[model samples]
Target: MIAKVMRGQDTLGLLRYLYGPGRANEHTDPHLVAAWRALGVPDPGRDPDADLSVLARRLDRFVRPEVRRHVWHCAVRVAPTDRPLTDTEWDHVARKIAAAGGVAPLGDDRGCRWVALRHDGAESHHIHLLATLARQDDTNPDIHNDALRLRDACRALEDALGLRPTSASNNTSAPSPTRGETEKAHRQGLDRPSRAVLERLARRAAVASRTEQEFLDAVRSTGALVRLRETGQGGPAAGYALALPGDTAPDGGPVWFSGTALAPDLSLPRVRDRFAGAPAAPAPLPAAGPWGQAATAVGELSEHWDGAGQGVRAAGAAALGDVLTAAAVAAPSHVRQVLQGADRDWSHAGRPPVGTARAAVAVRMREAARALSAAAPKGQAPVGELAVRQALQALAGAAEQVTAWYRSCSWEPQERSARLAAEALRAAVGGDGAQPTLNFTM
Candidate 1:
């Protein structure tokens, strides 16, 4: 549940807008009002534009009348772009709500709410609950806090209605009235890794090109453990799996990080495994300062790296050049895709529309071709189809590097930065004195 509180200027109107579509429970149904009246919940529909802060006080009015009613207001959302709730799923949310101490079946009309509403032209569904409190008045207020309470409520409702794992996190910080546990269990919450910290580590894993040993070393640097379980049980350690460092503090000791090669076994595969079951990834850490940008760029290019001009071709060079150039910038990945698509179209039809970025690259390739041709005797310039094709490929690659350097003006993400320093150091040593000698002084 990604919880965010937006400050709407009109509380009543916002509440109405959120809950009062043609499919709204309070609109087409009569018993919903009766249920609220019977339960002692406030008449939220009365003043459509009332300030909610003031209404919070008036909530006591509802608590005054209905003996069965208690306050429970939370927003449960779904990424409807994916799957709709199946028949089995409906049963799950209901069961979960019941387990979390919610009584009574949330009527059929209410269940239909899941299929309702469009938010910002995207299909979105939300659950607006009006239910009585299952716990007595003596329940701790900390248990009522939004962070812990809403998650617990969501998990319980989801499990009851078959919405298990609909979300990624099962945040258990709230005091479960059902658990009957206390301070020690609550203290366990500290061991949980925050999304921010996990994201930072994941991003590192995403770009890192380390081998298994180096990869495990980096995970340990982040204070995690890797342990492998055999046959998914403690019968024997099948392999190593990484766990949050302090998670074992309660039971005994920390575990080792046995790197599991999931993807291409590149740096990023390690990061991907950490967030395997999560719905959305955490935000990337802000590239620190200027040096941080260089470091991050280097990190992205590390391992098996050669000069940017090499034949393998660089990823994101189009995008990279756009950022550092005097020319109008466009997204490199998008530009590259569009050009290839356009080329395919041209092959099938006529010349396709090529954007500025593609046009520039094409021009550079042509120039490189002319230079290579001139270097050869005019008519004798490589004329074989195979020779011509290789020459063209090399020409285009040379143009990519030359122009990228022209665009960046100074630093490049790859080996150029180190080479530049080496060049200056060599120059300082005079024309023939670049090499160091054992007897030389600084």
Candidate 2:
């Protein structure tokens, strides 16, 4: 399940969109599944004579005029694989989430006015929750950390209702795509959101380069427009933003995303630390080749995972992400697609726990990344099957170690990512030079 929260000041505008056809004419039979009062509230979708203005005015009646953003909206969606829930079940889910969000508590007559709407169109499984912030008693409801609370409620409901379990809220995970982003991707015929594509390209660029300039150049080489942010008038670059060539904004300009927006570790300061902590000279490349060397290094870390401290383990996890990114860039076309998927999953798995200091163990893994980057084919050079197999075997082991490490920490998000990466790696190995069919959806 996924829940997104949005605050606004326009109740009428929101209601119009909710009851009427969606941006893509996707809303059909948009009826109220639940509301604060079961009997009196006017439902525009269900009643032929009901109007959007009438419904909006009723919801806003309790809200004070001084309250700038009195409208609270939350969208809840179930996983695609989950069984379809009836309108009654959806009403129950909405009530639970609304209570969790402090909008309308169960059995509280003084709670805020809210309604849950479900469409019987393309996206029939999910429902939209709309609530006025002011309660019936003319007091505002406590909404602090409401997003997190709603997430917890969703997790509990998943268990109670026999639905698919989702990852818990974590500061380290990348931000999920917004409704607009998802719609834009669908409109543009993109397989994933633009933010996701940019993040992957940024990760590859960050891992493949050793200097800030090189990072900038590598990012530009991928055809993304780059804008460097400096500290002062003429100071060195402090940060950067990226935008894809054809992806634009409502104002007919590029939609830029900063490095940190992509991921916490991708920030300029954190990226610089990756270079600062490494040895001055490049690590020696063995006669066995880059892939073989990376495999050996990964295997060594996996073997030592049990004895390593939290800092070392966290650093190793991050370093492993670098290895996967570099390898994806160097792999053949058929294998590259799967490697990219593995890299994406592993990215979420590799984030260090908050306050875990950087460790020196990552230096060795960074060396492996450097070697892979250096060994990437210039044109279409053939890669050895043995080398690819060895690398995949070692990566699978490392992913397993990551899975266990996250499981011990009881972090469901990273654990799931590591498990997915391990499965993809194993599948790739079993394919024997053929394209592996792996699900990349989150």
Candidate 3:
């Protein structure tokens, strides 16, 4: 499996992404340190100067096409498989990167500092890249000359190595998007935004809670003329939103982003309703049935959730549990209990930044457990032993990642580290239970 590690504010997010819902310093692992040195990018997380302010300036200059806020950042590490890479393969990979115009600034390294590094992990040999959105040459520098050459070389290299090309072939047409061409296309195929759109533009936009659900609900409420419905689960898991008449193309009609070429969950009808420019009624509150009632409801859904009602029931219970938990935690001492609830019981012996992450994980775990328990019928099993094994394996992974988040923390990443630890703990807990018990009797 290929994994992408996206980071924001440099050291601020690597832990959470790698380990799970936690903070981490750049020097999370010794191998990673060697990897960074091998790559040649400044290991800022280890250095004293790499504070939030330094990150602020860097992000402003890098990822933010808009005004930089809170070090908005992302990085993707592409490693295809877990086979041990021979020297020849590693060199070939390095050569391919160099051939692509991304050269290493540092000398005598296993991988180029600027381009990529092959990481040694359980799954595969993957490339770790820490990059900003900054372009090397903004002035349309000889696109035909350098770019064409780079693409051709890359294609040749991939073919030689028995690897698949990102696109079909080098003979494919070039990407020439002139502004004039876009305008012409607009004129040819379009009508103006409907009159309904004009009135619905927010007279005043109000920002709501930064909490994920609140933010998602806010976006969902936007009755765009075009919209994608949440599938499987709700919130982010339900997937991305495309508010047509809003998130839609400026010229009008459906316009999904990058790879969403197929029909999305957001239906055209839903978009039209939102085009009226009013918030939809909130999703109904979860029915506060008795524990047994809720358990039965959960069981019923889990058993038959697939095909007809897969994520629908799981998501509903998850969201309902969240509302209940959040409502219950506001009282005195409730916060501290969350911290103690999952303290240093695991190998690491310290709670992940047990504050912000606790609730988030709780909601997810309870939902999943309920779904699993509910899914297994009294006699008939829709899922097999393999499926249970797979689920457990996945859960183990989530737990490990959460542990990694805490393990990776360093002094420089103090705040972010704390935050990540908390989040990871929450996710691990949310994945299953805080005080999980393992029995060898089986």
Candidate 4:
């Protein structure tokens, strides 16, 4: 479950909107499932005669006229895959949210007044909670750190209520696409948001390059506009921003997104760490081609994960993404799309949770990535079917390891991504007429 909290000054406006049909007429059967003190608040949705103004006024009656933004609102939403929660279950959830926010404490009659509203028709099961900030005794409730508290409460609720667990509960996933980004992508006829596109490109560059200059060159090679932020005039770049050719802001300037804005690991400093103590290029491959060499290196990476410190494990996960991206770049036309899909999914699966200590790049896996990048044919050199099969098999093994690791940590989003990537790679291997074996033990 996830909770979004907002504050407003207009209690009546919020109440009316909650009870009325939503902007898209998506809200159905809008009615109160729970309210403060079991106060017998009138249900405007069910009771045609019940005035919304009356309920709003009652909720706000204890607040001083000078109290700005005294109306507290929170929306609690369950995962789409979770079973539908009954009104009774929703009431319990709303109460827990209220208590967590310090809006209304359990068993405290004098606590702030609040109401839980439920409506059908949305894709996900959700409830809206509205509360007045002032308590009955004229003291205002403390709402500091409410978001953190609500997050913790929801994690507990998911386990207690047997609901589908989510990565948001532990804040392990990447920053999700905002509503604005979604709408913008829809308007532009793009398959995904620009942020997502840029993030993928940045990851590919970070993995393929051994230095900042090489990283910039790699990004620009993809037809993305690059703007470097230098520490001083004519000095080395401290950070950089990227934008697609046609993506622009309202002022007609380029719509630039900094590396950090995409993900913490994409930040310039973090990207630099990926090449720390690394060779500029990989060692020459033996008679076996780059694809075969990368496959061997990737197959051996699981050993580093076992009995490794957090940093080493994190580096291994990240290096796997590098290898996937490199393979995607070098893959034959027939299997390139599948490899790209795996690369994209593995990007999320490989990211260390925020605040994890930066680790040195996994040397062997990074070398594999560099070799794959270096070996990519400049012309239309025919790619061997056997090489493609071997690469897919190695990628599948790495993804399975990632999935098991995330599952052990109870990180549902990363685990799901890794599992999906593994499935895609295995399917591709099968399509190439190879019965790939993943030997990694969880």
Candidate 5:
């Protein structure tokens, strides 16, 4: 579900386009679902024969008393689903629009006016809403952050309606375009105003590129200025920021957006995952050792995990335990015993404790959880995969929390132990045979 809010004046022109005949809504005759009239005005109550123009004109009067941009317009486009929406579902969506857009007053007799129209068009079915910002009492509902508010509303609706997921809709970090920015872009005839076009291009490049350098190059090719962010004590680039060279400020400084700020999918972490499992260039295979065996075992588990979905709920813990035991068989006797014990602890409580042996246990547990997640298969039964992924994530999160505790402890030996344990675990997990990071790629 995508909800776009555009605030402007000229309520009647929008009404004609929505209620009147046009290519965008020509096929959507009898489209008006519900109309909320200002208090003292007559209620239409889902009346198909209601004069939209008259209602619109009447609605406009309340806003006319206010000098601000009094017209509030929004379009809610639901992606195509396997099942068509019933009339009740359409009505529910209209309710969602009202509630989300603030057209529905907080109290009775607020006199706010609004109308919802369901449009079935060639491309997709959607709802168009036009509302008077000012209520019958000559006051306005707070619509200052309306675009972001509507986006959040759509996210809630997706979960409520069991609709398909969208990354941008789910993203909370991205700053949404304000009504003024949207209106300005429309006036200039820009297909996507503000950072939208740049965001789209960056996502495409991130998906197509094979390495960090390659991704940066691809973004640059689109005429975007790229800035790589370094991490690991200046070891390598770990993140990025991109900006359009053409979009600049008064002092000639280019406007920048972190990859994540543009869109969630274009975020550094997700984009890096796109090229996982396959490196930018050929690399040497890992040695045939215990870590290698563990990697191979995880890879096998990935293949079987999908088929086990039907029985996972009842048997998942036991199955993961079995896989963990098998994977650790080739390790040194002490390491194998540690791995087995960790798996048992995880199975029983889903988390291990931070104690004297916190370093040894937490590091291994974190790596194991990461390995399992990286090795999980993709491309089928997304809901099941998500369930499994959540389980793996819990294990990883628990370990990180425990590790943090160990680091903050008073004892010097414990902290040193943790650092050593972490280094050792990283070596074991980072070997070419595991390529743990690569496993998370789509």
Candidate 6:
């Protein structure tokens, strides 16, 4: 799940849009799954004017009297899962929001007037929220660090509901990308440049290099410029920054980022640890079936993604075949694990089927394969679309089986793992330009 937050004025205008009939001339309608006032007595289901009047009255109590900027709007979107959440599940989500946002339920300090609406658009499920920032005592609730708090809350819910934890839930060190930084990249003729490429190269270099000079050289070889910051008066270097030569900020200034800025794992201390004889990156488990082959194929596919040739279109297509072959090899082991119960991870509750694990691996592998197959070799046709669909269907079947087995075990690690696998599969099969959403899963 992903949550987006926006703060603004004009509470009534936004409220009208949220509660009014669907968008201009659109026939589709959004379901008002949940709606309630935190401290007020007005039912939000009343006429639009009444609803807005109540919402505005509450928001006007905030320290800032600017009605236009008195509201906070947010939306949470979840990827498709085995089945839609039940009413009971949705109620839990509402309660979670209240608790996470630091709103008092029944007290002198009860805060926020909010409602949640769910939409089943092309994207499976997403909920919209429009809320006042003022508290019952005509004061603002301290929402500082609310985003971080909400993320933690969502992770807790992910565990409770057996939903796959998202990247935000697992983030502990790296700061999220900001609007300015993203816009800068856009101005540089880049479309969501892959930070993974940078981190992967840095990691490989750190593992391969013995000295700082070698490390710098290794990074430079990857087309990234390394700028080392030193202490005053020629003292030992204090830190380093990296920048892409061809990519610059909108103002024509080079945009440099630190290791931690790229990813926490790439921080200098972490990289140096690998150089200081710390254990290398974790290897795939023994039962990871075709993982070895898939990894190799992924490496080649990455080359295509990184602009390996003028005709990358062709290289991408050929890469897909290699990716599929890797998935085909890895699928069986996952299936085998499900058929015969085994302890895959200590966190898992009951012994989950191998098929669950297989589905996860298979989906990720297929996504990589599909990405690489963007451009088939000169005269070589890629795998048939029917074959790809069939393989995906089989993986989905295994996932459904796992889900059914754990319908009543939301808190179980096995269920979480199954959800994670399904999510990974969904991401993998998500069509052209599809790249796996990198996240640290339980």
Among all candidates shown, the one with the greatest lDDT: 2
Q: Estimate, for each residue in 285-377, the C-alpha lDDT of model 2 and write its tens digit.
A: 787678788888898888888898887888888889999989888876667888877886677688856444466557777888888887775
Count of residue pairs whose backbone atoms collide, per candidate? 33, 0, 34, 0, 1, 17
The C-alpha RMSD of each candidate to the native structure, in angstroms, is 22.4, 6.1, 20.0, 6.6, 15.1, 14.0
Sorted by TM-score, highest first, which candidate order results? Answer: 2, 4, 6, 5, 1, 3
User: Which runs of model 5 end up more than 4 angstroms from their true locations?
Assistant: 21-27, 37-52, 64-68, 80-84, 167-442
Candidate 3: where are CA atoms >4 Å away? 1-11, 14-82, 86-118, 135-155, 160-442
lDDT score for candidate 6 against the true structure: 0.48
Candidate 5 minimal-lDDT segment of 10 residues: 349-358
Q: For residues 1-442, what per-residue lDDT tens digits would candidate 4 score against the true structure?
A: 7789999999999998998876655567888899996667998888899999899899988999889999999988775435788999999999999999998888888899999999764344678999999999999798999999998888779767855444464444555445456457655668767887898889878877888888899999999999989888787678888898888889999889898888767888888877876786567785667778777778777655576666666777888888888888887676778878787667567775634344443677787888778766541576656665776777787778878888898776567667778888887665357663422211
CA displacement after TM-score superposition, residue 83 of candidate 6 (Å) = 14
TM-score of each: 0.25, 0.73, 0.23, 0.68, 0.43, 0.45
Per-residue lDDT tens digits of candidate 1, residues 97-145? 3223232334322211111112221233333333333322322122224
Model 4 lowest lDDT segment of ten:
433-442
Which segments of model 4 are wrong by more than 4 Å? 16-68, 75-96, 104-128, 134-144, 154-175, 276-290, 307-310, 328-349, 353-361, 371-442
The candidate scoring highest on TM-score is 2
Q: lDDT per residue, candidate 6, 290-398, as tens digits?
A: 3333454344434333333323322232223224333432333333233122111111222222212112232334334333222222113333333333344344334
Pairing residues by index, what is the TM-score of model 2? 0.73
Tens-digit per-residue lDDT, 44-159, candidate 3: 43454434344334323423355233221222122231235554565555444443433222342322223233334332233344333333332111212334444555455544
- Model 5 TM-score is 0.43
For model 5, the local distance difference test gives 0.50
Q: Residues 1-442, candidate 5, lDDT per residue (tens digit)?
A: 6777887787777776775555433335436666674233432334556665677677776766546677878877765421345556766776666666676643445756777777663334677777878777776676666677777777667656655433342122334444334444554556555576676567445434457677688778778788878886967677788777666657889767787777544678756644544344433333432234334434443434434332221122222333343323323333444444444232221111221121222222223433333333321213232332333333233233333443454322222223333333333334335543212222
For TM-score, candidate 1 versus 6, the one ahead is 6
Candidate 1 vs candidate 5: which has greater TM-score? 5
Off by over 4 Å in 1: 2-199, 228-240, 249-442
